[model samples]
Target: MSGIIQLDNSDCSYIKANVSNSHNDAVAFEMKFAKDITIAQLKSKLEILTGGSASTMKVELYKGDTFVTALSNNDAKLGFYVNCDGLRLHVIDTFASFGFDSESVEKFELTNDQYEQRGDSVRNFLKQNRLGKYNDEEMQQMEAKRREHAEQMQKRAESCVLGARCQVTVAGNPTRRGTIMYNGPLEGKTGIFIGVQYDEPLGKNNGSVGGKSYFVCPPNYGGFVSPLSVEVGDFPPENFDLDDEL
Candidate 1:
């Protein structure tokens, strides 16, 4: 019969663990576990901290040399593996080694416009997956900075020349290309509005916008847009056919 060996209170210590993905990106975590902690218990803690499954982790203990033993038995207590304070454990993610096509890991960069396209989804994901280490004040400050940047971008777009080619993305519609005919507040409007002469008749009215006439244009060829929805860039003028021009 095998006898169980009890560890004193002083024997419990914090283990310095590093979990590395296939790309060699590593996150450090301080794990406090007693000598009686099982391999499964340790991997579970690592899973929560690293945002990965414990089943895919390959655990290795650092005692002194590279020949140190690996922790492969889920039922074995940590005491049966090593005996050292400040012991280090390396957890390699086998799931992340399968390449980009696998659902294991995803990496990509987004431009400013690309980010705005899926901003709502990105915000929700960030809020849901944020680490507990970030304080409330820190999160608020981050949000404030993001709002400020967006306001600055809108201001820059509003500074575009009146005759410049532009594009505006309105809710419930795809991006519409046009020319900035006017930029300012209109009667009965409290904020600045951008008057656009669309390439196609994808607009609500002629140059007269918001129940007020700002410029002359064919019917259903002009519209007013919000400065925030506008993007100024080089776009070729639309060749108007004589039939449609009427």
Candidate 2:
């Protein structure tokens, strides 16, 4: 007796297809689909992988870069389009050309303080793993460096005397002439901050910050800066008239 069985063409159940899309043409993926599956069903499955909506997607059949027929009828079976192994199933997302994708959707984000409070955050993971700043040796080194910087800044602040004429020379800013109004530590902040009363109205505050008054000065003519950027000099105030400018 012969032990071999014969199968007909009707036994073929699935077709392997190379899938791609218009938005991303650099890569193609091979996927298998049942021959009896309808076009709408196939589109619903493709939507998860392509990030395109099934309702607005247009599927086209291809044979190794050669153009074939489009699977336009959603109710028709995939096998009706003469689907075979190694054929390409290209998807065209109608709204993709108009910048529609997952990136276009608004996303929720957490602030620094909010993220720090979450136990499942990446910062908490690093802290538990004892990596980066959580390491004992690194923490000690960071503290030493911070103290060294504080001492250097304190030494620089000793040169900035109150009521002395000085010039502020911060990087990427025009040289400004001012008088040293206050020279000490600011409230609720580290390091020495130099309070200056600028000759012109080109400052961010009126000799106050966080509702605390450090000195007396007109509005928009007081600024607080680092002592390193201040130079005690014989700088005189320059006079200007608004009508002289073009």
For candidate 1, the per-residue lDDT at 50 reads 57
What TM-score does candidate 1 reach? 0.37
How good is model 2 by TM-score? Answer: 0.42
The residue-by-residue lDDT of candidate 2 on 24-102, one tens digit each, is: 6644665678989999999999998787889999998765566666889999888767433555789999534455576
- Count of clashes, each model: 0, 0
> What is the C-alpha local distance difference test score of each model?
0.61, 0.74
Best candidate (score: TM-score): 2
Measured against the true structure, the TM-scores of the candidates, in listed sequence, are: 0.37, 0.42
Prediction 1 global C-alpha lDDT: 0.61
For this target, which candidate reaches the highest lDDT against the unseen true structure? 2
- Candidate 1: residue 33 Cα off by (Å): 42
Task: Please list the Cα RMSD from the true structure of every candidate, rounded to 1 decimal place.
Answer: 25.4, 27.3
